[model samples]
Target: MPTARPRLLYVTDLAYPARGRRYGDEDVFLTSRLRAEFDLALCHPGDAVSLMDAFDAVVVRNSGPVLTYPEAYAAFRERAAERGTPVFNPLTGRGDMAGKGYLTDLTAAGYPVIPTVDRAADLHRLPETGRYVVKPRLGADSAGLRTVTPDALRAVLAEGAATGADLLAQPHVDFVHEISFCFVDDAFQYALYAPRPDRRWELAPYRPTLADLAFARRFIDWNALPYGVQRVDACRTPDGGLLLVELEDLNPYLSLDALDDGTREAFVTAFTASLRRFLAV
Candidate 1:
């Protein structure tokens, strides 16, 4: 008798209209490759809770911003956790998976991150800038993100406090460009950067230095997930130092299209191996 291959429930929102990236294209490519290894099925975020039980593991990829389906996402998470299901990137992630609260935590811990504060009283801790960014703690895809003068920031905080909403404030850094370091199971995979900040999705291959890897590694270590992929996003300041922008441990867009054929193939190989190991555990 032949052995049955592991089944994987691949969750994605193929129709999600992302600003610069094509969530559907990426997932379509990924699922095509993943199918070679596992018996895979695609479903939207709204259906994950009901379908995940039929699979051996769940691979959450390009599911789009959870803010759109907050109740469904919450229910999916709760069910996955309660059933002890193996979720890629594991639901235990402390980075973007949990919320933006980690920014304040990393800031307080002296990590090289954009200075962040979550309260009116703590605003003093941030440097004086012409503009500050105010964003919801649970925001994604630039949702609820705005740049405002200090006065406007204070007002926003006051309103948030009144509504009991969690928000984070950060100084508007004048960075030259933004870069992201991708990893699979604690291993560095590749790096990409946007030379023009205005066009964030125009990515090019980036060759990371020892320092860059070290910087990205800190957050990966901090997250401490024994398995799963992660993307450490950072900005290059005028001073040539990198500061953490976002540590994406949950369903980060791989930007596979930006990569060369060889590089894209390598990523698929690494991703497949990672998934295999994850299932064996």
Candidate 2:
């Protein structure tokens, strides 16, 4: 007799109205393909905690921003950890999965990231720019992100300090383009870029150079998640250098629609294999 296929609880917010991208379509496409090898059931982020135990593994994909349901997300993480349930993107991710605090940490460590400061006292560390970007430490999908003049930024930082709100400030970077390197378990898969900064989701396939791959790999290596997918987001500065913008380790959108049929099929193949490996562990 054949063995039963692995059961997977795939979490997603199908109706999530994400700007410039169809969250539902991407997940629908992914789940449809994933069902081929696994016994999969789709559920919303809010339902993951209750349903996770019944499945062999939980695959969080396009679940939307956790900020929308912080308590539920926190509970899911806590419960999953306590039970030692296998969660794809393994709860061990240190990038966006944890928070934006890594930005400041990376900056302080001399990584090629946009200089970030979480406290008003560290404002002098940033380069003098006409404007600065202020974002909440736990922000995702541009939530609580703001651009302000230097004085306003300083005032805001001071206010945040007084209120004890976690915030990070950085000099606004004037970059030529934004690029993302997609990877599956430390292996580079593919890359995509938004040529027009104003239209962030209008993505085009980008062929990464050796240097670009090295730049992205540095962050992936730092994150050090032994399993799960990651997308290393970066911006190309005016001087033609890549700087880390965001490292998404939690439910990073694959933008599968942006890839041609062959590439998309390849990604699906890789993703399915990764899931099998994750469950075997």
Candidate 3:
């Protein structure tokens, strides 16, 4: 169904200033590698709806947080869905791609996620910890997040819930390490971890054991996305177990530069292949 080379509209914000991540550099590197197999054109997320029609597929990469341009992003999604355009991370992702509401659902369902509750009535569900992490259910990149003690949570919830602003409150997790598993279309590519909990971006290659793989795979399989990339972010608890922190099925920042050459190449190959297959459908 494709010609000698497929055409891709790669969506990214080349100038987005992420706190500790180089969104542009990673996209430059990825598009460079991808160009070898496909005819690619880069565009900011805002322009995707305008430019997407000409390409065989639209590859939505590090386009920054949707909160940056919520209305434009909504328009892009509406147009794509209306036209049945092929988006790489198929618009059906149920994790962060959808919203953080899954955290509350998963918490109620007894998943190993950090306990989350939104309503004032649900406040009692959370563990009694010194402080709690309260964040917008539709938030990204830590926007509008606050750390509050139990005494103040009630007042915050009263205001937050009244505006239909779904909120998530979780006890501050004391973890040994934060690790992430990267996957392309349900296949695990590699794992990385931040040894120093304080330095979230200072990562190193992590070789996941069978148990680790099993833990990550469960969430991936649960997501059941036949295409698109997903990142399973977890933290090693003090009790020597992994707890799901977030399922990043949205614009996950791939730290490819941190990986070894071989690993990086492998991921690129897998990603390119997955994109090809996804576009074909």
The TM-scores, one per candidate, come to 0.97, 0.97, 0.97
TM-score of 1: 0.97
lDDT per residue, candidate 3, 16-135, as tens digits? 998889999999999999988899999999999889888877889999989889999999999999888888888888899888988888888888888998888888898898998999
lDDT of 1 at 225: 95
What is the C-alpha lDDT profile of model 1 across 158-230, one tens digit per residue? Answer: 8998998888999999999999999999999999999999999999999999999999999999999988989
Candidate 3 residue runs with Cα over 4 Å from true position: none
Alpha carbon deviation, residue 244, candidate 2 (Å): 0.4
Error of 2 at 109 (Å): 0.7
- The superposed Cα distance between candidate 1 and the true structure at residue 236, in angstroms, equals 0.2
Runs of candidate 1 with Cα error greater than 4 angstroms are: 1-3
How many clashes does the backbone of model 1 have?
0
The Cα error of candidate 3 at residue 114, in Å, is 0.6
Candidate 1 RMSD to the correct structure: 1.5
